[model samples]
Target: MSCYNHSNPSSFLLMGIPRLEATHFWIAFPFCAMYIVALLGNFTLLFVIMTEPKLHHHTSLDLLIYYFLCMLAGIDLVLTTSTMPKILRIFWFHSHEIVFKCCVVQMFFIRSLSAMESGVLLAMAFDLYVSICKPLRYTTILTNAIIAKIGLAVFMWGIGLMTPLTCTVSRLLFCGPRVISHSYCEHMAVVKLACGDITLNYVYGIMAANFVVGSDSIFIAISYILILRAVLSLSSRDEGLKSFSTCGSHVCVILVFYTPVLFSSYMQHWGQNIPTRIHILLADLYLLVPPMLNPIIYSMKTKQIRGQVLRPFYQKTEVRINFY
Candidate 1:
């Protein structure tokens, strides 16, 4: 009860990796490398996409794809940026304490941005479905105005899904030990430190996980199925290959993004018998892996992006953008 009357906000200690404290120095190197790669990859993708005339204005389909790629690259950048530095600090400097309020803020950004990323992937799936399965109506259905609304909806979808959870967490009485058993201010880890009944937190977290992940996974699967059917119906083998090539990057991104996420989320909730170190490792890897790989996946799969990447090596690459 007296904890509720404390003058200062609670400061929680972050354990970078539970059992690998001695190897923090060595571990920091690879994690740091991944962060650097993610930064360069995502930023280069953004710059090249923004400056590439073909991707920007070749066709309405190309334009819409560019817009989504921008959104995806931007999201990956923010998601990694929000949590990785602090994690590195924890690993290298042993800077582990985070204020309760700061923890809440971190929690908000990680949770919301993750959900937003999922929404964007779902949007991408829809875009692919329309492009492949309903090619003629694609232009009519996905104008710039419609794209803007989709972006807004993706942003709001994240907020709507996470706001309640964040608010509930903020209002909880965290009167117990402030030692969080993970690298960052992960929501369940923080919630585990709270004093009172956290049944609502548990239930809401499970439900939200189901609603966001389950539904999006289903829709994405359905979209891909429709896309596959449409592609297979094509009499030309080359056309089917091209269609698969178009979706290959997206499928890879989806797997990279969602596989670890689903594993970590459910394992954290249900895999109590599982070692804490495994969860911590996955959490750290999951944050960095998708961001680092997404751009590389796209670059390898998309010819235009690959050209822009190699362009500077061959010639003085010049890219221009206009502000109106």
Candidate 2:
């Protein structure tokens, strides 16, 4: 079936999901709820971290680490909102047409931010490892200058890695099928619809994803292992538990973010026996679940952040009591 190439098509149709068109209206409800929760939780967490006086101090190493945490929140915000609105649009309103330029932008953000999150988590894990495994050197090692450098390096690396993908996809002539099967413009999904050879896209995409996720996971695992060893060597069990708590929230965040990613990746590639709907759902969950759970996990596990969250309420209560 030879068709003329439309180098500049007006738009592409995004099919919400396969074999579940009728249920899309009902499916929109839970997704909307999760999106609302993610917005509130992540925004509130970002606000508290930014406004809290202690976190603003220039001389504080803790300030840099907390600022880095703010990066995680920002990443979560972008990651969730990047695709969810279009997804909700598809499900609720049957608004499945994404502008061609918009689709390219969406693909860039989704892919770049996913890689950035893995790097951010690894950076945080390394910070935790230093804080726990070498308490005395934590301050000396991860200084404000060093932290700033590390953050810069991660962003440069992530963005640099993903920038080529946009070029590769953009240059492809999309004269073939215009209907994308996924709710959002996933990279491979969009690429598949294009005419001509896309072997580079496939190869680069796989290699880049594996490099970011695989390398980061390895480092994160090593960090946690050393952290565990350090915790065990502590003189007291209470001290060990206390030390472990520092990385607990981070550990939870890593698991939530990475597990679904790996599982979904596998299901889409090798798990041929799995249902398409199931794979799609898992992939969607990979983006949604972590953002929703991250703030909750940190709030519950990290006392400082929890206090930052509750301070305003406590102050209001104090004022009311004093007046009464």
Candidate 3:
């Protein structure tokens, strides 16, 4: 796909954390902190899951956790890489111009990552339902082989679904006033600058959101309904409690991930009065905060994971201190 041949602007300004005076140290501080935290948190989760024998237990629930963690790592990279470089440019030179190619790449990668997140969440909901509703067949349904197959399918679907939409966007002509209204080259922000007709792109964008966001959310809701029905049928209180607790964390995470997506999608499609600042803030939180929060939330409630993963790190640090 080729960017529309239009006169390039001198530079683009990022309106980040509004009203704060842009100072080198002040601006770089938050970006650096968020990037490091996202990296360390997702890395720890992935490392523990890969290395710990306890986490290697062959269970339907464990497979779901591992799937979500892998998705979260991808998200962490996508979120930080998409915008942090721009933040650094602002700190160093007060502003920067994104080459046409760089802008298209940013837009594609960001949307693709967010769309892929919805896929992962839907897969997780299916995993939960199978574990609860069909316990007898879960071993057969969610084996290592099946989990690997599902993961590959979800990623492939993410790629197939996003490629064309982003390609369409790349063809649009971007003219003067390249100053993006927000920190990143969001799909809509870049497309809006196009001097040419974006009607087809808009149509495809809505369709993508409907299939990726709407369909995933509906499936998740249905999966939970089935899970709830199965839990209610259980006569034992202990069994019901365990099921509820296990699903509660996942439900919370799903809400965090999807609510903002639907909010932005709705405003774009239906024409809402939501302010740009509010929309941008929510979008950033949706992309950035979730990656940091998921690993923390999972580690807190999952006792086996906590003990097997976090405890070993602490024990190792203590051993080093004693030797010193």
Candidate 4:
């Protein structure tokens, strides 16, 4: 039997997100609080949505919305757990030496969630399209069976798309000067340290983005445009306005979710001179802010959630005000 020693990077120093005074106590403290709130908020939303039968059966879109929200929450957890702790560590101890296996895992976790999120958004878009475009047959077209199938298809797509990415990065032989410029084990950041040919990996990454995220955006845009036209041609202003309002939260959530991702991915590919701080800020916003805002958005937009779920809390506050 022949023994082989696998080549690996010597060491990598993460240029942790920008600093005010390098102590980072102020930055890391707020970020940690945000992570904790994000975790609790998302978990609460998922639990409430799943448990409330009235909320669950409100419309054909309800189930899909719940599923999408849950997926986003899960992504939020993965991102915060993967990146925030590292940032916290740097702030507290100034330790940025990420092991080879941990680096790979971090890269995989980030990419997997980022890519799969596109698919989940696509699923929601499809649900909205079918509900509006094919109103009469919405139930028949998007039966539980069909929803399950679609969920399965998206899952398969996400897994298949991300596998090659993880595999490709894992195969790279790491050596000296393994310092990644970014705070986290971002795909491009880690790949840049490879002492091997990374041209193929870069090409594959671009292709992956185009195939999964690019196509999903195109489809979502088309669906919304059709929905807009359909809404515009309706006779009653109240009916049209109500329908538009229902989807407004979703549209806002989508914009907030995708814009940073598009910006970060674009800069990573095309803009080389962007400030490192901007990159870190955009990535953090892409991962953190959306999850925190999602439940808030939906709660405000959804009458049942606002009235039935949030009303009781508000009423108590109103009572306190009256008492005072």
The TM-score between candidate 3 and the true structure equals 0.86
For model 2, residues 1-324, the per-residue Cα lDDT tens digits are 212234857899999888899999998899889888888899988988877776576445467567777888899999999999999989988898999888888988988998888989999988888888887887889887888898888888878999888778878888877999888888888888878899999889888888889999999999989988988888998988887777778888988999998887666657889877877877777788999998889877866778888888999999999999
- Model 4: lDDT equals 0.76
**What lDDT score goes with residue 130 in model 3?**
88
- In model 3, what are the clashing residue pairs, if there are any? none
Looking at model 1, residue 18 earns an lDDT score of 95
Tens digits of per-residue lDDT for model 3, 182-298: 666777777777788989888888888888888899999999999999999999999999999988878878877777778866765565577776676566656666776777777
Give the lDDT of residue 287 in candidate 1: 94
Q: Measured by TM-score, how close is model 1 to the native structure?
A: 0.94
Best by TM-score: 1
Which 10 successive residues of model 2 have the least lDDT summed?
1-10
Evaluate model 2: give its TM-score: 0.92
User: By the TM-score metric, which is better: model 1 or model 3?
Assistant: 1
In model 1, which residue pairs have backbone atoms overlapping below 3 Å? Answer: none
Model 4 has a clash total of 3
Worst 10 residues of 4 by lDDT: 1-10
Off by over 4 Å in 3: 1-31, 58-64, 91-93, 268-272, 312-324
Q: TM-score for each prediction?
A: 0.94, 0.92, 0.86, 0.90
Candidate 4 wrongly placed segments (more than 4 Å): 1-5, 18-23, 318-324
In candidate 2, residue 13 scores what lDDT?
Answer: 97
